[model samples]
Target: MRAAGRAAPTSDPAADASDLRVIGRVAPHLWPPGDREARARVVAALAFLLLAKFATVATPVAFKYAVDGLNDAAADPRAVLLSLPVWLVLAYGAARLASVGFNQLRDAVFARVGQRALRSLALSTFRHVHALSLRYHLGRKTGGLSRIIERGVKGVDFLLRFLLFSIGPLALELAMVAVIFLVVFDLRYFAVIVLTIGLYVWFTFKVTEWRVKIREKMNAEDTDANQKAVDSLLNFETVKYFGAERREADRYDRAMAGYEAAAVRTATSLAGLNAGQALIITAGLVAVMAMAAQGVLQGRLTVGDFVMVNAYMIQITLPLNFLGTVYREIRQALVDMRAMFGLLDQPPEVRDAPGAAPLRVGAGAVRFEHVDFGYDADR
Candidate 1:
């Protein structure tokens, strides 16, 4: 359980109760040094990720080769006598396959380790909750608490896998793309791409924070609406006895109306965010494209180079959307995970003695049929 020699987290009444530091606390359990196999799995996953990244970068290059080859063949039909175009086409497909193959392989390798971590967190929280005092359970709602547990389970899994596979990998790929632009293309391309991404991120974070607040309001209203409906249904007999069905329906409708308005606001704001991100990306693409087109006009770049530049930008830019999604999800999910794991932070009212030994029994040991316990003399 508590990572041998490590004391369990205690409830600190004086501690800042903002975020529970969920990721920080539970992340280490994902690959405990005690498990050599987990370390190996992570290493293997990283290797696959590296290969996937290279393959992804190479895909645009292969496309460029194919495009250039065909363009040359067309310019000089005599060159068509050679079948290099055919091979280039095949190379393009191979590059695409390699990129996809390695990405899937990376996910497969890391999945088990992520699940193992999820299980550990689940087990730790499960045991911790059972160890807490009866009052904690008495004060909880089974339905709401179970939902928290489910979402928390999902949160931990997503946090581990997404951070490792999505967020971290995307950043690495973007860096690699920037480096490629600088080394193979031009500095202007690199600068434009970087600046655009910076603005895109800044704009997304700013708008997304605003949207998060709206979503929270919507969720709160939705929860209130659901609670009203549930309470109304459960007290149906009372409503019927009083002939208050119409009144109950009116209250429920009012609650839902509030929720509907909040939901609409959330949808409307999300559209704005999407539009802003698209504008940023499109502007960046146009700037880069203008540079690439100029190279073509000057005969400094072949059609293939233009195609490659476009392809690479598309590849690099697609993840910008996911990067924003990941940032928002991590913030939201961590909030849930913090609450779920907060149960673990509650100091157990009961625990073993500092050096308690296991109870010894003979071959035929008797077990108690009934037991009694107490917290103190007052109880």
Candidate 2:
């Protein structure tokens, strides 16, 4: 236990170590040994994820072809009536639909796996809290402890969903888009894509790292406020007897005041982060579109190609837009999970001896032989 005056833990080498440890601990639950059904579900989910990403990457290509075919048909009225690019249009719509459908299927299939892991981890944490010695509980804050478990459980769910769905798929799609740019379009397009991605990722991570501190401050105040409220309410009769309602309200208000300040900082920092991200994304879009337009004017690429570049840029931007928020939440979740895992790391104060026989009573009788107990062993 930390002293009251001690500062809250920040992200450091030790915290990173704990975060890795938590991931390792939770991994087994997600992919439990001897659970064929869970394993099968995981495999199916991956299959769907791949299909979804492939469809997503192909959507822009299909659209490009549809546009090209329509442009050709427009050159001749007879061709316009005969060759309306129906097949290309259908393929474009189908690809878009398939992308969404497969993504939904992946989530539906993996829902069981995520929820199971959440339940298992939550139950383990609950039982471990109960098993800890009374001395430990007596010194703990119930409200804070409960909040840790609640946040940790929620963290597990978010990590499972986003780490697999958002992060992995984003990487896969980015790679595919890069390949398309390199193969079908000019190398310049690919270079721009790579540079933009690099800048966007680096900026998002740096800003999010700073925001994490503000988030931690907010969480600490929130936990403190909750603890004060719960503690006051639990001792309601004592407060009434002592006529200290005003004192209790003042204490709670102080905690809330800190929370309010921290909350405001979080919101303001988030706005700045969003603004910076938007600037980067917009700059990338403009640069790429300008190059594409130049290619069209120089007869190096068609109007359809310009539109395709725009489509792919929009596709990439959609995920990049949320990158900051997702990264921040994941970091905060790690912090929460680390706290919960700390409880699980504690060794029980009492345990049955190895291979100890169970007590059997024919006629129950209390027996005491030199038994002495004190809450503090030092006493």
Candidate 3:
């Protein structure tokens, strides 16, 4: 159920408020829910998530064991150089498969949780819009209003999946890896992993922050271009009578030119961000590998342990490569969803009294006093 004293959500996406505020506004509809089944599904989803993390963390270790067994076989004169340990190989494959299986199970379980939340929000928004005063409907564009709600609806699903699956699971896996290193290996190895991760994350945040502005520019220009084209085409007869087709085309081209420039910049900035993040991971891998090599040469670690280090780093770095992009999109999702969420902050133009009654066919005339709803007045 909703927390106490929160503003009621409206259908207007332009309602301005913080993400937490917006989420709180919709919280009642999604959680501490009246439906017991939904809560169960949420619990099941969390359980699956934990299972997935366990499997993911174990996968690298399994592969390491397989590699070590093969290394031993190679050194034995009685054995073939490429002879494989059947059980180790099977365990490694199982680890990989189990991780994927658990991940998919989590998604399947959580799908209902997300869908229910979206449905509730969408229905609430619909009812709120219908309850609004006629002036509110007259003042808003149907296309813009629809797009805002659509984005907001889809945004909830995206937010849930990204935060729960991508960010949460990856973090848990990282922690598990850190623990494994501390318990079974060296502190220096853990430090290398941690340092590389810290640098990679720092670099990603800095670059992604820069990209956020570029995205804003691109979105603004793209909207302007689309709006200009729509307005011009919709008023084609007026433009014909005024002999302004060429003028319309020029304005449209100018808007598109701005959009084109912004789009190009976005592509270029994304490439740079990817390259910088890759470099951070590469350096981290080299440092971790060096430590592993030193340990192996000193007989402090087995050949298998060295291979495990590489496997774990490779696995960790693979997901991290997309972390920046995922984070950026998550931020954008909040922004897109904010408009609808912000509606909660808007006070309605009309509301019934405590003892209000539904209007009847012969209801008395409506009356108002001391109201200043000028066309230009901010709502």
Which candidate number has the best TM-score? 2
Q: Estimate, for each residue in 197-257, the C-alpha lDDT of model 2 and write its tens digit.
A: 9988877776666665667777888999999999899999999999999999999999999
198-280: candidate 3 lDDT, tens digit per residue: 98877776676666666767666666676677767778799999999899999989988887887788777767777777788
Sequence-dependent TM-score of model 1: 0.81
Q: Which lDDT values do the candidates have, in the order given?
A: 0.77, 0.84, 0.75
Task: Per model, state how many residue pairs clash.
Answer: 0, 0, 6
Per-residue C-alpha lDDT of model 1 across residues 1-379, encoded as one tens digit per residue: 0000101112333322443455668758867878998888889999998998888888888889888888777878876757698787888899889889988998888888888888888888777878887877766655455666776888787777777788888988888888888888878989998998789877876776666666566556665666667767777799999999999889878878887887778667767778888899999999999999999999988888899889988998877866667776766667668778776778976789999999887689668977986554443
RMSD of 1: 7.5
lDDT of 1 at 28: 82
Q: Pairing residues by index, what is the TM-score of model 2? A: 0.93
Off by over 4 Å in 3: 1-17, 25-29, 73-84, 230-245, 355-379
Candidate 1: worst-modelled 10 consecutive residues by lDDT: 1-10
Scored against the true structure, residue 241 in model 3 reaches a CA lDDT of 100
